[model samples]
Target: MNMPNYFELFDLPVQLPVDVSLLTANYQQLQRQYHPDNFATANDNDKMVMVQKSAMINDGYHTLKNPIKAAEHLLSLKGFDAATEQNIIHDADFLMEQFVLREKLEDIESQDDFVILDDFHSEVFARQHDVYKQLLEFINKQDWEAALNQIFKIRYLTRLIEQIEKLQEKQYAL
Candidate 1:
């Protein structure tokens, strides 16, 4: 089966930061065009095709909506493999920084104060934003290696932020 290029499907440029408003509009258009309800009276084969098209549209919209996923898609379109298990981040400094952040998160988790958790959440988000900016710059320069490294860092920071948010929720419930 031939897979459609998501950028082509959305009439979008193959870039990191896609035009969100345009993407959303295009997505809604596609969704309406291929909605299963429209195919209710169609033959089985045509109905199946519409369902497949709708699934692809949903997948493409979600993939393009997320920055990391969009970056990976862009890299894939450029013939670079997205992060695989083999593509380990070798930056010792980044690894060390993540370790430090994890330690801080643990300390905050042990504390009863919501203020510290909020502060940690902010710090993690700032770090994630910094890495995201670097990823954008690297992608613009076509520096796939650096961009992949930044993707890894961003992934780590995202998980850390999620953990902090979970802890905050738990604190709020107390």
Candidate 2:
């Protein structure tokens, strides 16, 4: 079966950092066109087809919405396989930095001062932003390995932030 590429489906240029306004407009238009309710009176086979098409459109919209997902999709379209398990980050310095950050996050629970936790959260956010900047550079150069490494860093930072937030909630409940 012939399937439209996500960029083509959304009438977007096949590139990173897509125009979000155009994507949202095109997504809404596609939803309206393929909405199953519009085919309520059709036969079961046609309804099923519409449901599948709607699902595909929704999936494309979501994938293009998130930066990391969009980068991965672009890489896949360019024939890059993200062998994440095999493609370990080899930058020893970066890994050491990550180790230090993780150690700080793990030690947060031992601190009694809420101010320290707040400062740590801000620090992690700044680091995450730095990772995002690095990711953009790698993506522009089509350096899939470096980009994936940055993606991994961002995911870790995201989880770290969530853990900090959960701790804050628990502290507030006390």
* CA lDDT, every model vs. true structure: 0.87, 0.83
Model 2 residue 137 CA deviation in Å: 1.4
- Residue-level lDDT of model 1, residues 59-101, one tens digit each, is 9999999888998888777766676535578999989998999
Candidate 1 segments exceeding 4 Å error:
1-3, 83-87
TM-score of each: 0.93, 0.87
Per-residue lDDT of 128 in model 1: 93
Candidate 2, residues 1-174, lDDT tens digits: the string is 643489988989987787889999999999999999999999999999999999999999998998777877776676665544344667788779878877886787787568888899899889888888888889889887788877777777788889889988887788
Q: Residue 163: error of model 2 in Å?
A: 2.1
Candidate 1 clash figure, as a count: 0
| lDDT score for residue 68 of model 1 | 87
Residue 166: error of model 2 in Å?
Answer: 2.2
Off by over 4 Å in 2: 1-4, 83-87
Q: Which residue pairs in candidate 2 collide? A: none
